[model samples]
Target: MIQKLRQSGTLLGFVLILLFFALKLPDTFLTARNLINISQQLSMLAVVAATMTIVMVMNDFDLSVGSMASLSGIVAAMIFTAGYPVWVGLSAGLLVGVLGGLFNGFLVSVVGILPFVATLGTLTVFSGMAFLLSDGKTIFGRDIPTSFSGFARSGIEIGDIKIPMLTITAGLVIFICWCILEHTNFGRRLYAIGGNKEASHLAGIKVVRLRLIAFSLTGLGAAGAGLMYAARVASANPTQGSGLMLDAIAAVFLGMTMSRRGEPKVIYTLVGVLILGVLDNGMTQLRVDSYVREILVGLIVLAAVSVSSLSKRRQS
Candidate 1:
C-alpha cells in the first residue's frame, strides 16, 4: 500500500479530496447540475493551467498568462465589436498569446534574464496593455454578436448528458497538451531540459528553441482561455483574468507529485484544477468564508510543494 501510494499519490489525493467534498456536501455537491457547473466554471482556468504547466515543466514560469488572457480576450472582443469575423478575432487572440510567449522566451533564453524576473516584468506590462485596450471598462451587448457568445453557450445534448462547448474545448486542449508532452520529441526535450538544462545542453539539445515553444504555448493557452471567457460572459474586461494567476499556478504545484514524480503531466494538472474546483464548490455550498477558503487553498499549495520536494529528494 505504501509503495503503491508512493507511485500514484497525486491521483489518490485528488480522489480523497473529491470524496471529502461529496460526503460533506452530499445533496448539493454530488448532483448533476453542480457537477456541470464546476466543469463550466473551471474550464477556462483549466486551459490556462495547461499552458502554465508546459512552461513550468520546462523549469520556467510565465506570470503573464493571467494578463495575457485579459489582453487576448479584450483584443478578440474588440475585433468582434468592430465587425470582423469571429475567426479573425480568434486568430488575433491566439497571435497575441504566441507573440507574448516568444517575447518572454527571448528575454529569458536569449537576453539571459531569470525566468522569474522576466515573466514578472512582462506580467505587469501585459496587464497594463489589457487595461489600455479596454480603456479600463467591461465590454458587452449588441456590440458583441450572438455568434461569438455561441462558442461558450453551445453544447452537445445526449439523452441524459450534456457537455458544454467550452468544456469540450478544454478537454481537447488537455488532450493536445498530453500528446505534445508525452508523444513527441519536443516533449521529451522539454522534460530533459527541466530535469537538467546543463545536461541537456551538453547533450546537444536545442534548449533555447524548446524553451521558446514552451513559453509560446503558454501564451497561446492563455489566449485560448481568454476567448473562452469572452464567449461565456459575452463581454471582456481588463479585470476579467486577474484572479486566475494564483489558482492556475497553485493547481500546477498541487499536482507536482503525479506519477511522473517531479515532472507534471496533463492528467495530473487536470486533477489539480479539479481539486481546486471541488474545494471551492463544497466550501461555497457549506457557506465557508471566501477568505478562509483562499487560506485553505494556499495551505494546500504549500503542503503539496513540500511533499513533492521531499519525495524528489528521497528518490534522488
Candidate 2:
C-alpha cells in the first residue's frame, strides 16, 4: 500500500486539488465551459512538458526551450507579416527550432559541454535572436491572416462540449511523444544511456547520436508550442515563451513522482502539466495575486523534487 501510494501520489494530489477547487468555486469551477477553457490554456504547456520528458529520460535538460520557442514564433510571425504563405511561415519557425536544437545537441554531445551550460547559453542567444527579429515588438494586427489567427480560435464540438483545436493539436503531439518514448527501441536505448552512460557506451549504444536526436525533438516541441501560442493569440512577441523553461521543468519534476524509479515519462508529464494548469486556473479564479501564485508554484516544485529524490535514494 505504501509503495502504491508513493507511485500514485501525483494523481491523488490532482484529484484532491480538483475537489478543493470545485468546492470553493462551486459556481464556476465545475462548469463545462470553464473546464474547456482550462484545457485550452494548458495545451501548449502540455506539449512542451511531454517532449521535456524525452530529454529528461536521457538525463539531459534543455534550458533553451523557452527561448527557442520565442524565437521560432517570431520567425514565423515575421514571415507572415511579410505576406508569405502561412505554411511557409510555419515551416520556417519549425526549421529554426530544429537548427537550434541541433546546435545545442552538438555543443553538449560533441563539444563535451554540459547540458545545462550549453542550453543556458543557447537560451540567451535565442532570446536575442527573437528580439532582433521583431525589433523587440509584438507581431499582430492586419498583417496576420485570418487563417493563421483562426488556428487557435477554431475547434470541434462534441455534444455539449466544445474542444479547441489547440487541445487536439497538443493531444496529437503528446500521443506521438508517448509512442516514441514508450514503444520505440530508440527510447529503450535512451533509458539505458540515462541509467548508466558509460555502461551503455560500452554496450555499443551510439550515445551521442541518440542524445542529439532527443535534444532536437525537444527543440521541435518547443517551437511547435510557440507557433500554437502565436496562432491562438494572433500575435508573437520576443518574450512570449520566457516562462516556459521553468514551467516545463517543474511539470517534469512533478511527473517524476509518478515513476517508481523516479524517472520521467510522457504520461506522467502530462499529469504534471495538468496539475500546474489546475493550480493556476484555480488560483486565478480565487483572485490570488500573481506573485503569490509564483511563490506557491515554486514551493510545489521544490516538494516534487524532494519526493523524486527520496524515491531514487530508496531505489539505490
Candidate 3:
C-alpha cells in the first residue's frame, strides 16, 4: 500500500495541477482544444524526454542533447536552403546525431572521461558547429522548402480537434522507447549495468557497447525533435534548441520521483513533460512573468529530486 501510494503521488500532483488550471481558467484550460494544444506544444520535448529516460535508466547523462539538436536542425535547414532534397538533408542531420553520440560515448567508455565532462565539452563544440553551419543567422522564408516545412504542420483532424503530425510522431517514438526500456533484453542489461557495472561486466554484459547505443538513441531523438521544431516554424535558428537539454533532464528527474526504484520511465517522463507543459500554459494564461516561471520550475525540479532521494532512502 505504501509503495502504491508513493507511485501514485506524482500522478496525483499532475491531476491537481490540471484541476487548479481548470478552475482558474475554466473557459480555456478545461477545454479539449486547449488540452490538445498543450500536447502539440510539448511534442518535441516529449521526443527528447523519451530517449533521455533511456539514458538515465543506464545511469548515464547526455548534456549535449540541446546542442546536438541545434546542429541537426541547422544542418537540415542549410541543406534545404541550398536546394537539396528533403531526404538528403534529413539523412545528413541524423548522421550528425549518430556520429556525435558515438563521439560522446567513445570519450566516456573508451577514453575514460566522465560522462559529464565529455558531454559538456561536446555541447560547446556542437553549439559552435550550429552557429558555423548557419552563419549565426536564422534560416527562414522561401529558403525552406514548403514540402519539408509541411511535415509538422500536416495532421489528422477529428471533429474540432486536429492531431498534429509532430504529436503522432512523438507518440510513436515514446512507444518504441518504452518497449526498448521495459521489454527488451538490451533494457535488462542496462538495468543490470546501472545496478552494478562491475558485476554486469563480470556477467559478460558489453557495458561499453550498451552505453554507446544508449547515447546514440538519445542523439537520434534530439535530432528528430530538432527537425520537427524546424518544420513547425518553417525556420531553424542556431539557438533554437538551446533550452531543450535542461527541460528534458528536468522531465526525466521529475519522472524518476514516480518510480518505485527511483529510476526513470518513459511513460512517467511523458507525464512529467505534461506537467511542465501545463504549468507553462497555465502560467502564461494567468499572466505570470517568464522569470518567475523559470524560478518556479527550478524549485519544482529541486523538490522532485529531493523527494526521489528520500524515497530511495526509505526503501533501502
**Per-residue lDDT of 138-184 in model 1, one digit per residue for the tens?**
88997678998987888899778788999899999999998999899
TM-score of each model, paired residue for residue: 0.94, 0.96, 0.96
Query: Which candidate number would show the highest lDDT if scored against the true structure?
Result: 2
Cα lDDT, all candidates: 0.86, 0.90, 0.88
Clashes found in each candidate (C-alpha, N, C closer than 3 A): 0, 0, 0
Q: Worst ten-residue run, lDDT, model 1? A: 1-10
> lDDT tens string, model 2, 219-279?
9999999999888888999999988888999999899888877788999999899989989
lDDT (C-alpha) at residue 111 in model 1: 88
Report the CA-based lDDT of candidate 1 relative to the real structure: 0.86
- Clash pairs, candidate 1, are none
Error of 2 at 224 (Å): 0.5
Candidate 1 stretches greater than 4 Å from native: 1-7, 311-316
Q: For model 1, what is the alpha-carbon lDDT of residue 160? A: 82
